[model samples]
Target: MTLSRALAIAGFVVAGLALLAVEWAARRPDSRVPTLGAVVALVMRYDVGGLPVGRLAILLFWFWLGWHFLAR
Candidate 1:
């Protein structure tokens, strides 16, 4: 696989894991995963008029990366 494809896949995998981590953290607030809890809190607190800026930016980044790699 090309480097771009590899990177895109890695990015997606990491993002998925982060979402799972956030969920886990949310379920058990006393959980020791401070970083994940912080991430969840940041996402929960920040927004662009009702929309989640962080998630939206992530999706857009992934779309742009996929397009850049696959369009050639």
Candidate 2:
């Protein structure tokens, strides 16, 4: 296999492992690892000049992701 293809596969493997770790952590009742929802809530709590800058940042990120990956 080409180096690029091998690197891509390795990246995917790492991502999958990370996802599994998060899932495992989230399932434990007393685990210190925060769930994804908690993380989002924490981000959403930030504000600047009474504007929800954190939410705006997350919305912009989603828009950019969709524009690049889901746009036809």
Candidate 3:
């Protein structure tokens, strides 16, 4: 594999681990370390008047990206 492709795969693995850790933290009621997901929850407008389309699409993109890298 090329250097760039290898770097990308490594990055993806790190990101996936970080995201999973954040998600785990966010689920904990007594956790002190804040998660990126929590900050995004405050800032992002995932829904206007309560629709989930925008958030769902973004999630799909992330999933596709992870799959693409791992499939390489």
Off by over 4 Å in 1: 29-72
TM-score of 1: 0.42
How do the predictions measure up, each by TM-score?
0.42, 0.72, 0.48
Considering TM-score, which of the candidate structures 1 and 3 is the better prediction for this target?
Answer: 3
Task: Give me the candidate number with maximum TM-score.
Answer: 2
Candidate 2 vs. true structure, TM-score: 0.72
lDDT of 3 by residue, 1-72 (tens): 999989988998999998898779777898887776666565455677787766777788789978975877
lDDT of 1: 0.78
In terms of lDDT, model 3 sits at 0.78
lDDT of all predictions: 0.78, 0.90, 0.78
Residue 18 C-alpha lDDT in model 2: 98
- TM-score comparison, 2 vs 3, better candidate: 2
